[model samples]
Target: MKQRIITAVVALLFFIPLVAIGGMPLQLLAAAMAGVGVYELFNMKGLEIKSLEGVLAILASVLLVLPKATWFNFLPDTVTNITLFYLIVMFILMVPVFSKNSYTFDDAAFPVLVSLYVGFGFQNFILARESGVTVLMFALLVVWSTDIGAYFCGMKFGKNKLAPHISPNKTIEGALGGVICAVVVALVYLLVWPMANYNLLIMLPLTAIFSVVGQMGDLVQSAYKRHYGVKDSGNILPGHGGILDRFDSLLFVFPLMHLVGIF
Candidate 1:
């Protein structure tokens, strides 16, 4: 418990500053996250990655965040699609060349995983910034509320398991508590400063639904760790575990917010 507090404090101390600075700093932070995440994704034991797979991962990630081709006039069209096709074309063209390491199909999944994890997940932050910081802040707050609320509620009153296989710690009662806390947080934020330019009536419910998504995100990550026989993704973030651990909910929430136009 004491260690968790210290970890949370240290994380906030680092996170608040980077978020406050915005712009390139934020981009750099996202890039670093993507790079590390991709590296970890590729590091799955018994997984085989091709020589150009790393290049594809980086390309997919950058293009996802980069400015639209409309600005440069010389930029290529369908950038994401083209890069994806590069994979398909390469696989089909080179299948005969591999006498061994026949698990090409398995290795290919890593790039897609990395591409989506870093691209779609982080792209929402860019969109959120354009809309307003409050947009991002609220999304983040709800995720936190869920995480905090669930922990306390579960320990005290939880009965039914949320996902016994993936995450034994989670409970259905805890999930309800998280929903309640998230709604309360949203209402308080609304009272403090009414959000403009978005429909709260619709957004409130959507945000609650998104809180559920974030919890599932945590569950999925936990399941991955369980499968790999690891306690966490990496040891880079002290008690937090890894970048993925610190931002699991954020990763799920960001794309959801973008889809709903709340960010």
Candidate 2:
């Protein structure tokens, strides 16, 4: 518990400043996170970090994230998007040609998927921040509220399991508690940022929806680790686990915000 609190504080110290800057610093942080996340995923699959496919996977992950940096603002969005896609396709093609069976279809495909998953997910963070600090901070705070609400609520009143096989700690009551908590936080934020222009009725459902999505993202990462026969993703953050473990819900929220045109 002490370690967790300490780590959270340390992270906030670094994260708050990067978020305030809202540009290349944040993008570089995102790239570093994606790199570590891809490495952890590869580690789970028993792959060498320095292997041909592994290096490509990490590099691709970093590259895919770079286009979102503030420096790349000069380029058209269409150009950047297409270029990354083309490069990813070429990377996949080159895998089989350069090294037969050293990297299988699944092996090659995994990194690309991770690149899209982690890379584009964080890219959306930059997009969200660019829209407004309030938008980004609101999304983050809501997710955090959901997690905290669910933990305490579940510990006190949980009964029925939310998903026993995937995450035994979660409960249906806790899930409800989490959604309600997120809605409350959203209301509070809107009250403070009164010019938000979002109706309470609409905000309630949106918060509830994203709260559920955030929980689903947690379950997905849990399932991933279970499939790989592991517990935590890595020990980088001590009690907090790895980049993926910490950002799983955040990752899901970012893309969803984009889908809903919030950013």
TM-score for each predicted model, relative to the true structure: 0.84, 0.92
lDDT: which candidate is best? 2
lDDT of 2: 0.82
Off by over 4 Å in 1: 46-52, 66-103
Model 2 stretches with alpha carbons more than 4 Å out: 72-78, 194-197
- Local accuracy of candidate 1 as per-residue lDDT tens digits, 41-104: 5554434335466656766665565445422336466554346435544653354357365646
TM-score of 2: 0.92
lDDT of each: 0.72, 0.82
Clashing pairs in 1: none
Question: What shift in Å separates residue 181 of candidate 2 from its native position after superposition?
Answer: 0.8
